[model samples]
Target: MASSPLKTICIYGAGALGGAIAAKLATGLGEQVTVSVVARGAHLEAIRAQGLRLWEAGADRPLVARMTATDNAAELPPQDLVITGLKGHQLTAAAPGIAGLLHSGTRVAMILNGVPWWYFHRDRQSGHAERQIEELDPNGELWRRIGPERVIGCVAYQGAEVINPGEVELSNNGRFILGEPSGENSVDIEAIATLLREAGVNISISPRIRDEIWSKLMGNAAFNPISALTRALMSDIMQNPALAAMVGDVMNEVKAVAESLGARIAISVEERLERSRQIGPVRTSTLQDLLAGKPLEITPLVGAVVSLAKLTGISTPTSATILALVTQLDRENMRAAE
Candidate 1:
């Protein structure tokens, strides 16, 4: 069968990950693809005034492409693919508008952290089908607006940050794992994966993406919240025996919950901890959220595990304690800001 021509790709958030993807697409795919970004505030303004700039290693490059950007989805044409690069909480806020940007065949790839809202639905044998994660989606907004079928799970393994408006600092890692909800290989999946690969991303189609999701979630579940609450970097968290053990406890609990759901983690807890240590002096997204005074993704990142533990008849005492401490700190931070 002949492959369908590539359609325009719109990256919704245009943050660090989004910007890197956009730059790579614009550079590699060129006119073969139309790239647009949806963003707001000073960043959006800067991108509009001056083209998006991407800096990697020691080189800076200004990508010259006529990309569309807007806060409103109504300002653009119906998208064939919409890559959501927003944080978990940001997705809920932008759900309604995002729904308006999609047509029937549109695929919405979620590239956020923690467990996705559609995690349970993708597991057929699991009893919790179409389960709504209230801590993440709250009020069933994302569940209703963006159906699970339209979702393509993406796990980003990159460390990029926006240094200033319109410019992003690219990190050493730039790989993305893509998978379908049904875990089947399809034309649409191949098309998107090929486009991403052509755009300079190390893209792979996984038969068991849920397993990969949980594996990554294990690290985020422990490192992110703990880092935020303690205001420590990854190296410090891994070096301190006590903190590392606390992280280990959280991971062990999460591993139980994941196994209960039939998602077997390939990596051991000790190996995963060593991997974190290898990442060196990296600041987790949770710590970044805390420092930026943005809302921390505690509910989806940690609370969802607690909810899953309840569903699976498992206990997660350490995770529960950490969740409590982080929740308190987030609330206090919000209160002080208010």
Candidate 2:
């Protein structure tokens, strides 16, 4: 496949994942492709004042990537590619601004957790697909605005966190798996994959992105909410045999739902749980969001699985219970913040 030249790339929501991506792209692809970031508050200020400072997963020194930084999306030029690092819950709100970065040839790559709004867009079957997950996309704003034609499905396996303003610490350096919403290979998709690879990001272009989504979601659906409710890291939860069993149950339910939807998750539940234990004292993204007083990515992470269970007519009692508990925790967290 011939690789097309990438003129410009913009990363929306330059937090952990976005910042880590920006750092690599700006530093590794310097002058090869134009890199810019859309961030806000002190992080934006620091990026503007200084370059993005990134401590790569296992490095002694941090790397500084100087690139364009702005809070105003309107200020950015039309991009060849726009990678949205915002959580599923945050996408609709940021949809309009994200739209401004698009041109006719631009591709929007979403690298977030759990089920995406585009899950059923082209990957739909007769009675199983959802036209709208109201919990994830209220009022169909993202669907109407961004549309599914321009989407590039990306599953980011990497774990990173913004330790402070203008700085990101990568805890895991995993491959980014990408595919088209319609599950077709294209020159544009190949181009984006090549660009990321050139920029030192481990990348894979999947034939069935949904399978990849579920592969990651199975773990996220179990780990994230459990960590939030228990206020524990992956290590802490796995240390307790009872908690580990519960996590296993949640994962099994999710696997059932995924297989019902015709998505194959090759990894066994035991393997996923074991991997979680090996990750050590890592805080799940949901826990981090709760601790920061930010909105929870609950709907897509856990609620989506429960919704799928209903669609598949499968009973997910354990998943439902955990979803209920976590949803309330999120509601209370939001209420208290207000």
Candidate 3:
């Protein structure tokens, strides 16, 4: 007899990224894989009541998967893979609740932006190994609860958002890079990659996932905070030579830190900035968070780099200054919200 296929995979934070992945899996993988989503508030109700609505490629479509939406995680079964699409800060809030959903062999793929909580674990030569990012992790709850060994790093390049409750709009780019902490090609990693690739995501199993993480981080560290602080789109920020130059300085400092950690970025600062420019006018998620009145994820995105610089004996003056400014900005924003 044939073996039973992978039964259940949950997209824990079923926002834009989660919705897209769920819809694709429900469509392509069908009975071979079971897709469930975990969400809250109107989004959760919408998915439960009306199924998930996806808008992509200039067409509106809906896929009704065997989804479960609950603010609680104990209600769900142990999952084969739990794809976490929450922002770094949001993960902290939900970590305890979601801990029960993981079995011993479960792979928790973190699809967040900036530096993940597990960054230093995979980085053998990084001086910051075993050092916790207090600003991001806060109380070391995530590092303690989840542990780095269970993590599979994912760098999401897709741009998407929820157009309405239970509905998502895919803007462009649906690529996801996956790798293990030890950079080995394992069966579990490939299985997860296969599911994602079948779901229309450009999934690549990278040998040097740290390089990809830093490459993406180079753009995020500059563009995200700058966009949030200035309230400008990508094209507008890149067009202003002075502002663009300021971003370049931050990138230079970050590159130095990466090199010191033994992960040298192949692209120059200017080339990376140009790549952002070519993406045209786009509002980063940090800017979106500010507008949405959500907490700014500055610590993981910027502060982690600054902390890593200190560990590696490198100076990140530019990143340090920008981080300070963004922290103040986030504080004021939080006060206003209160």
Candidate 4:
């Protein structure tokens, strides 16, 4: 099949990060590309009424990017690029909807945290050989419906939040690390990078994207759960002696497991923790989800680590305990909401 001209883009889950991307692309592209969002509820309503709004730090006013917004993906035509910003647990349920927005040349970018569902799909060097991550995709719904071949691995380093129904505030303008699973500098990957760069977004293409994924996960697996469990900020977690040490332990375990599975950790545990500490007093996405009464990405962030540890004979005592507690918290909180 011929490569797509790459004009159309659909952001599957237009919450914080997705909203930022959509707003930037739609506004910066200036009719060059057609950008749309799949959003629902009050957020969807707000976007439909007033367009997607974004407020980056230091900006005097928010950026209102006029674009199409829909709750149903089936309503839209086949897209050239589908960027999925959904949480790990949410991806499975949204898989079929995402499929409704694709064509043969469509590429799906998974801009998510922790270990992605398609982590083992085409990376044969891991010796996992297309094995499904049980925690992230237990039913194989995502793998079967979305297909790993369409995935463009992405590691997003930005922090943003939905302050209101349709308004998102960016904490930092971070770049996205994108790659292809086949380890080839394919046309699809470069095209996506070119589009993102043209929109004033920083992007880096890597052959060893799995290494970048592991490097990003090292901080998230520790910080996200801890933030939710303690209601602490990034600065708080880094400054507190007890919490800092605990995250360090979890980082070490994650590093071991990743190295065992053929992923190279980019930095030391101390360096990772220090870098996190340097960030401002910001609430993590997990903590934000907990406060919003939304489902936490526990299974993907922490539970997945424990599962991998058992597989690789890596002892993750700290990670195991944190996973258990957060799992219970998620269950009890959801049960009470009902």
Winning model by lDDT? 4
Q: lDDT of candidate 3 vs native?
A: 0.82
What are the lDDT figures for the candidates, one per model?
A: 0.83, 0.88, 0.82, 0.89
TM-score of each: 0.95, 0.96, 0.94, 0.97
Across 1-338, the per-residue lDDT of candidate 3 in tens digits comes to 12334578888888888888887777777677777778889988988888888777566555555466776787889988888989887988888866877888888998878878787775676655666677777798888888888889999888887778888887785789998877889888888887777667789998778888888888889999999999999899999999899889888888887788778689998888778778877788899889988899887789989988887788888889889999999999999999
Ranking by TM-score: 4, 2, 1, 3
Winner on lDDT between 1 and 4 is: 4
lDDT by residue (1-23, candidate 4, tens digit) is 22337889999999999999999
Candidates 1 and 2, the one with greater TM-score: 2
Per-residue CA lDDT of model 1 for 164-219, tens digit only, reads 98888865756788988778887888999988887778899987778888888898
Global CA lDDT of candidate 4, please?
Answer: 0.89
lDDT, model 2: 0.88
Regions of model 4 farther than 4 Å from truth: 1-4
lDDT of 2 by residue, 190-212 (tens): 88988888889999898889999
Ranking by lDDT: 4, 2, 1, 3
> When superposed on Cα atoms, how far off is each prediction in RMSD?
1.9, 1.6, 2.0, 2.0
3 versus 4: better TM-score goes to: 4
| Model 1 stretches with alpha carbons more than 4 Å out | 1-4, 57-66
Better by TM-score, candidate 3 or 1:
1
How accurate locally is residue 101 in candidate 4, as Cα lDDT from 0 to 100? 88
Candidate 4 C-alpha error for residue 60, in Å: 0.7
